[model samples]
Target chain A: EAGVAQSPRYKIIEKRQSVAFWCNPISGHATLYWYQQILGQGPKLLIQFQNNGVVDDSQLPKDRFSAERLKGVDSTLKIQPAKLEDSAVYLCASSPTGRGALAKNIQYFGAGTRLSVL
Target chain B: SQQGEEDPQALSIQEGENATMNCSYKTSINNLQWYRQNSGRGLVHLILIRSNEREKHSGRLRVTLDTSKKSSSLLITASRAADTASYFCATDAARGSNYKLTFGKGTLLTVNP
Candidate 1:
């Protein structure tokens, strides 16, 4: 099976500029997630989606970041007026829903987009 | 302050040696998972041990969970240069949908050839 896919492996933009990252999860996976990994740290959850509905986004920076999974398949995460602190790797992951606890939480991750803010 | 905290922030060893990394969490969890991330890449799931499980093994990886102590350890035996990477432990809370995984700062292992 194909793994989760993310585009624009690396991106660089000036602060206050806008950038967007795209993700295509594995086929038939109903749950999608976005995470940010700063250098020297583990990935941090940004938002989670159960199909087209959001399950959790508590850690998302609402003011500058937004994400949508309108079709409940492919998703996009955007950051406007990006800041220097936004320089990090953006990872997308997915998993099958409604399965057993063991299977449900087995997330498959994409290679991630490396973002650099100047 | 963080849910998961890994010890020995970094580990370096020669190939063919065993590498052990420890992680400690603060809350009760339904399960704990270990993952490896190569530099400049995403994380790859290694293994998962449920609260009821004390130990699990997959190929060269072994994970042991101690619920009473809220801690876990990952042992990689006969390490290879390819084993060099950052290892992380993630904890799944006992509550909610079990979709969220609280992760630690991670331990960087460098297996020299």
Candidate 2:
């Protein structure tokens, strides 16, 4: 029963540089998500995947941001030409099911990668 | 776009007192959930109340949902210093597009021992 795992707890990059973050979700979890949480603000959903298929990514910045869950167990989110506005915490979360039908079905989050673009 | 907004952006209270946080959403929802996050940490799920349910309790935590008003409240009884954290309310709208959760700005609560 391990929790969701993420790599590079903190990252610092310069504007216009590229950065990538990785996430390994809980075992047997079928859904994974990537969210951006700016300082003093709530998390904004960037993308979602259900069993290697994208469920939603309407809010993602297609020009600069992209994510993929190739094998359905792990995911990676990338941002190219990072801007100052992209300096926020990137959180990775996983859910047991895609429907969220269970009464206690909650999205378990990883420690998150804090990106500081200078 | 953010779906939920929490009130009283920040609060400070002494230990053994009660702490209440409110959240309001703009659209209909299938369920609402509350989560707590310590500084520089990931969020931890606290409670979830479905649309058909009015109230739910877990130990010292009590949650009340009013669909007519599109609002929800979280009450922590006999709060302690350990309860100091940012509390966020997330909504899963009824539209059923994989049931994504939309979060709010959150309420920062500080408890003094």
Candidate 3:
């Protein structure tokens, strides 16, 4: 099976501008996730979706970031009025199962979109 | 907030040697997982060891979890140049009906051939 796919392997935008990244998760996967990894740091969960509805997005910055997984397959994350601090690699992942302790949470990740906010 | 914090921010070793990386978490977890991220690439799940599992082995990799101490370790036997990458430990903390993973800063391992 193919892995999670993300678009625009790299992106560059000026501060106060807007940028959007798209992701297409592996087929049959029920859960999708978006994460941000700043340089020298591990990826941080930005948002999570189980099918077409969001499971958790508490860590996301509501004022500037938003994401949606319509139809439960493809998802998009957008950042408006981007700041320099937003410069990081945006990673997309998917799991074969949904939420719960018994659910298998082995996530498969894409190459990620590196955003450079200048 | 980050739950897992890996020890020894960076390590450099020659091939054929054993590499050990340690991680410690703050809260109770259902499981802990290790992932490898190559330069400019996304993370790849290396292994997952449940809280009930004390130790697990997959090929040349061995993982040990100590819930009492809230710590875990990853050992790569006979390391190779291909093993050079950033290794991160993620703790799965189940909240109510939701499950999420909190990751650490990671350990940068460099293997010399």
Candidate 4:
């Protein structure tokens, strides 16, 4: 099967500009997630979706960041008025579900979109 | 907040040698996982060890988890140049609505041939 797919392997944008990244998860996967990985740091979860419903988004910057998984297969994460701090790699991952030992929390990641804020 | 923190931000090893990386977490966790990422690439799941288990092995990879100390270690035996990559430890904490993995800063390993 194909792996999770992310668009625009790299992106360069000016501060205060808006940018968006797209993710297409593995087929039949029920859960999707968006994470921000700053240089030299681990990935920070921005939002998670179980199908079309959001499971968690507590770490997301509500004032500037937003994400949606409309059909439960593909998702998009957007940042408006991007700041220098937004310069990081955006990673997308997916799993079959979030329960049981068979498929509880094994996440497969994409190549990620590296964003640069100038 | 991040759940796992890996030690030795960077490590260099020669082929045929064993490479070990450590990770420590703050809170209780259900499971811990290891992933490897090539330069400018996505993360690939290496292994997952549940809280009830102490050790697991997959091919040349061995993982040991100590819940009492809240620490884990990954050992790659007979390392190869292809093993050069960043390894990260992720933990599935008990808190929150669902199982979300909190990753560590990662350990960059360079295996020279």
lDDT of 1 by residue, A1-118 (tens): 8999999999999999999999999999999999999999888999999999999999999999999999899999999989999999999999886677688888899999999999
Name the candidate, 1 or 2, with the larger DockQ value.
1
How do the candidates rank by lDDT, highest first?
2, 3, 4, 1
Model 4: residues with Cα > 4 Å off, grouped in runs:
B95-97
Residue B16 of candidate 4: its Cα lDDT? 97
Candidate 3 clashes between residue pairs 3 or more apart in a chain or in different chains: none
Off by over 4 Å in 3: A98-103
List model 4 lDDT by residue over A1-118, tens digit each.
9999999899999999999999999998898999999998889999999999999999999999999999788999999989999999999999885366547588999999999999
Between prediction 1 and prediction 2, which has the larger lDDT?
2
- For residues A33-102, write the lDDT of model 2, one tens digit per residue: 9999999999999999988999899999999999999988999999998999999999999998645485
Q: Is the docking of candidate 2 incorrect, acceptable, medium or high quality?
A: medium
List the global CA lDDT of all models: 0.93, 0.94, 0.93, 0.93
Could you give the DockQ of candidate 1? Answer: 0.74
Model 4, range B1-113, lDDT digits (tens) per residue?
Answer: 88899988999999999999999999998889999999899899999998999999999999999999999999999999999999999998865638688999999999999
Q: Could you give the TM-score of chain B for each candidate, in order?
A: 0.97, 0.98, 0.97, 0.97
Estimate the TM-score of every prediction. 0.98, 0.97, 0.97, 0.97
How many backbone clashes does every candidate have?
0, 0, 0, 0
Q: What is the lDDT of residue B91 in candidate 2?
A: 94
Judging by TM-score, tell me the better candidate of 2 and 3: 2
Error of 3 at B27 (Å): 0.7
Docking category for candidate 4? high
